[model samples]
Target: MQQTAYLPLALALAGMLLSGPVLAHSEQHAAQHSAAIVKEQKPWGIAGEPGQVSRTIEIGMSDQMRFSPDQLEVMQGETIRFVHRNQGKLLHEFVLGTQADLDAHAALMAKFPGMQHDEPYMAHVAPGQSGEIIWTFNRAGEFDFACLIAGHYQAGMVGRIRVLTN
Candidate 1:
């Protein structure tokens, strides 16, 4: 019959139209996955805009109850590369937050392993070991970094971070 005669032509036209968009979509998806793989291999960082001002600083914590430099000053909204080295016999945490925040969190820390050192904002460095953290203190305030190893902070192991006005 006349209707059945156009079956082959209709099928061919439908396949051609579908293939065009399908091929383009598959190629775009492949490119996106490739780009994501490259990003995963990079170092620790605070996400920011292009050409943003930033700097890296090395901080060391020791058993002697101290953080090297004692006090740190940074510009508001600037990135800080924190490299923490623990030269102490016990585990140490390089936490950045207000003094009250540290104190409040300290009590609940014993529930977790490594003193919550595995947080994205902190890198727990064991004795004689090294690690890094990327922190951006976007506001001007006083933050205290301490090794809340029970008696550590009480023995004066706390340090100060001063983020300057914008």
Candidate 2:
């Protein structure tokens, strides 16, 4: 009877310990899914088909708060592949949106530093790592790409993309 009583207590303790990580994983997964849904709904641009990529633009992110070729001009309805490489020794992200959207997102990021999420319009790159974002600029206007990592955006880590009429 002593062993039986201890068994329930031990199992309860194990469950408590295991549940923390499991719950955290679930929360992260949910946040990522939410982000994807929002991305799909918003009209920044549509996800580009891999077969429809018209050109590839390689961008490099660095510790100096900058992106190579910060200004991009694309024709409306053109699809482009953005290859992002993190050449810096810090975590960085390439998020594409309008200036207003980026500002709001950066504020949210500053408020919740631990927030974890991903979408097709965002590439979270670690130091010396690389990622890609393929997008179709069906809308004609100006968009932006920025590293909204707290102080990074304030430090001039921003790029512009202008979609021109074909």
Candidate 3:
């Protein structure tokens, strides 16, 4: 009977202890959710509206760390619908950013192999599957796209995009 009395207290204590991590996870999730709702303008450009897409470009990703038609050219203010088809056996992602930004992100990905991120300029594709990113090239400059999946970036799974001024 006395032992049964302690069960409730022990359960409460356990619940309190576990709540810390649960709260942390909830906070992290909330932050990520809020970030998704707020679109920040990047140096490359802003996210494109699906209805405003000017053209569509299909890109292929393979296990060999290569992107078919790796070089791309776009005119400023053009909204592009980037369709990414992953031909490789591994999971892949297409992330558009400046070279420096991609390099930094790659380093982070190498350190945290299981990190999860989402943005308008990124598309995570599964093997034998497809994903897409609709982006507007409002800024005229050279930018980069890459698969910053752990060692994928190091293996040269990167591409170049040239946004010509209109």
Candidate 4:
């Protein structure tokens, strides 16, 4: 009779304990959303509107550490929707930024290989999955996009983007 009375209390305590981890996970996801908003306002370019897209480009990633048509050219002020397809058997990402930014991010990724983060200019694509990122080339300069998945970057999984003036 005493054991039965304690059962409800025990289950209640267990439920509370389990909810702590779930709450933490939710907070982490919220943080990622905030970071993405911050990224959208940064100098690389504002988040492009789908209706304003000047062109659409399809890019493919493979386990061989290569991107199809790895080099791209766009005019300044052009908005592009990049359709990224992962053909690899492993996890891949498409991150767009300058060489310096990519190098910094890659170094950080190497240190925390299991870290999960997102930005407006980044897409995390799984094997045989597709992802999209809409970006505008507001500045006239050279930029880079790469998969900064630990050893993936070291294996030469990088591409170039050049924004030229009209």
Identify the candidate with maximal TM-score: 3
> Poorest 10 consecutive residues of model 1 by lDDT?
36-45
**Winning candidate number (lDDT):** 3
lDDT of each residue in 1-166, candidate 2, tens digit only: 7899899899999878856765675587677766643436355688787799999999999999999989999999898999999998999999999899999889877866666657778888999999998898889888899999999999999999999988
Query: Which pairs clash in model 3?
Result: none
lDDT of 1 by residue, 1-166 (tens): 9989999999999878856655564566456545532222112223333345388788888888888977988887787777888888877777666678678656545333232224445566788998876666666767778777666777887888888887
Estimate every model's Cα lDDT from 0 to 1: 0.67, 0.86, 0.89, 0.86
- Give per-model TM-scores: 0.63, 0.78, 0.80, 0.78
Judge candidate 1 against the unseen true structure and give its global Cα lDDT, from 0 to 1.
0.67
List residue ranges in candidate 4 displaced over 4 A: 1-29, 32-39
- Candidate 3, residue 105: CA error in Å? 0.5
Candidate 3, residue 16: the lDDT equals 83
Number of clashing residue pairs, candidate 1:
0
